[model samples]
Target: MEFLNDYLMIIIWAVVLVGTILIEFETSDLVTIWFSVGAIGALIAAASNVNFFGQIAIFIVVSLVLLALTRPLTKRFMDKEVIKTNADRTVGMHGVVVTEIPFDGKGEVKVDSQIWRAFTTQKDPIPVGTRVVILDIVGNKLLVDVLKEDL
Candidate 1:
């Protein structure tokens, strides 16, 4: 009990450091790592016989400084380009209607040697072999439009 009384702040800061590191591992998002660093600062202050409030102030200042200084560099490393899927590549592409598309219903269109369920907003039914333009995808269906002969 006497030993704890003398080292309570040190123990608390050590626990905080371990807790923050565990949280950082669970997320890996650079979120709690700053707190872990701050805990290290507080631990140093505690070991130096600083008062509890001074230790807390050291923790806050260290965490804020590290966050402000390193956030942009971390963001640059973390931000990644989104890769497009095969389905996403089909947008704004041309396809052929393989089956007659009933008005306001689904049909099949062939694009890049692949057959896809497709639909259109046109009032009339699109005939088989009609050239179509893939506008977008809704679920597994392709939203299409009639491709005009002139571009």
Candidate 2:
């Protein structure tokens, strides 16, 4: 019975660790801070032979405390960099279509010394060598609208 309790704590800790990693990967959101604390608390409880209920209580309390304490710090850190990547930095910039972009699918554009996959916002196809204005970023692709004069 005692062994089962310890094993359960260990399992809970392992689950917390895995959950944190998966959440961090999927959304890149800052939600795993408390999960990491819960994992650590469960690990400590297991090592110290703490009872099952005690372990759960400790995990919850520690997780909440750490989350509250670190939320402001994490927010500050995340907000400090307004744009972390070159792609994020180029959302509103103008670019030239290097390849003809079909209305149905993908195309390429050159912006700020970089070539990027781009998509047309209009129904008609945009030809190569046309000037385009980037409207927004959709993942790795740029949403673009052609310049009126190029139409």
Candidate 3:
């Protein structure tokens, strides 16, 4: 009982360190990485004969400092959304051919409120009133394909 009481700090530190590392691994979201490092610091302090309150204070301070320093940086790189341009916004959108688009030729397509110069993949001419999907934007033109009803 006396041995367990004397080594309680070591036991707590071991449990905290392992538990935090496991949680970090499971989540892989950087949520518990700071705490895992802090637990290691606390474990080192406990091993060096630091008292319980001092170990806890060290753990809290280290964890908070690390979290503040790295959390935003991690999120900035991880949660980045794709930057879209005015033309890029039309990709995968359905449009109607407003002018005949023959192979190796140009035409116009109206998607929503915007009319864009468009071209089609089909070798046959895509006449007016045909439904198409924007595939890509090339300079001042839109590359499009016929849209199947099921898609």
Candidate 4:
């Protein structure tokens, strides 16, 4: 009992530091890092013979202060940029219908030397060999329109 009372704050702070560091490594969210720093502050207080309540107060104050001060700056630095893909380049390009496009069903089109599943909103069926203009891609399918002259 006496040994535990003497070292209790030190043990608790050490455990908190290790646990927060492990959690920070697993998540990489820049959150638990503040708590680990807080645990370090508490550990220092305990080592310096600060009262138990004072150590707890130091931990809370340090953690909250660091979180409030740095989280927004860290978030801005961590924001990811949107990336363009090769598939995105297909929009606005022209293609030829390789299979008859039934008004209610999907069809295949040949665009830029590659074949893609295509769909159209036109009420009439599109015949094979008709020219189509790629509009947008949905999932693995392309949304297309008949070329103006093909109407």
Candidate 5:
């Protein structure tokens, strides 16, 4: 009976290790950190012939500590490497106005073979077919100024 219990504990640990790896592959929301701790604790308990209750307690405590310590560290790293989904990468590129820019509002421009939301930095309306330089990116829109050569 005792040998059977130890074998079950080891099997549980193996299952947890496999499940954690699978979950980590499926999503990147930082959910597997605690599972890793539980798996480690189970492995240690199985190797040391620790009781099932002690194994569970150790697993819970170790997982909680690891989760607490890693949560903030993972969050900080993720925050530092935030992905930008804006037109900032398009700055300094040239494009032509696809629509007639209104005197006081926004328009559209074609850059990199793609149409994008754009606006003029200057007060004057930029007519269609005029080349413009991307000056800055504001929100989802591109701030542009007329290219002197295309004027």
Candidate 6:
């Protein structure tokens, strides 16, 4: 009981700091990060032999302050809609035929920075260097059509 009071704050603040930081890493949602920052303030204050009330006050104040200051900024920047995949990006983009494609045979086209296996709907073969648009993706292949230029 006597030993508990002397070291309780230091121990408690250390655990809070480590625990909140672990949760922050797991979540990456900015929810627990403010609490971790607050715990750090308390940890330092407690380690420097601050009183119990002072340690708790610093903990609460720093947590609330950090939360208030950074929540809006974090929401503005980190909460935006995130694109998870680039598969949809390939659609509607223009690419150049890298390998002459027979109507019934597989060929290759260079789109943006990627080379994709390509196929066509026409019976005639598309020559290399012809500009094409990706129409759809089938398995690992890109279904493409020649983009006719304005005369």
Across 48-129, the per-residue lDDT of candidate 4 in tens digits comes to: 8888899999999999999999999999997889787899999999999999888889999999999999999999989999
Residue pairs with backbone atoms closer than 3 Å in model 3 (clashes): none
Q: Name the TM-score of candidate 1.
A: 0.57
Better of 1 and 2 by lDDT: 1
Query: Evaluated with lDDT, which candidate comes out highest?
Result: 4
Give a tens-digit lDDT track for model 6, residues 70-132. Answer: 899998888768555678789899999999989999999999889999999988899988999
State each model's CA lDDT, in order.
0.91, 0.84, 0.87, 0.92, 0.83, 0.88
lDDT tens per residue, model 2, 1-151: 8788778779778888788878878866687868776878778888799877887898889889988898889888777555567667787788999999999899999999899999976898888889998888888999999866676
Candidate 3: lDDT of 98? Answer: 96
Give the winner by TM-score: 5 or 6. Answer: 5
Point out where model 6 deviates above 4 Å: 1-4, 82-151
Better of 1 and 6 by lDDT: 1
Candidate 3 overall Cα lDDT vs. reference? 0.87
Clash number for each model: 0, 0, 0, 0, 0, 0
Q: At residue 29, what lDDT does model 2 achieve?
A: 64
lDDT value, candidate 5, whole model: 0.83
Error of 1 at 146 (Å): 22
lDDT of 6: 0.88
Tens-digit per-residue lDDT, 1-151, candidate 5: 9888888889988888888978977877777968877788877888799988888888889888888888898877756464676456789999999987776788899999999888875768898888999998887888888887865
Give the candidates in order of lDDT, highest first: 4, 1, 6, 3, 2, 5
Query: Candidate 3: worst 10 consecutive residues by lDDT?
Result: 1-10
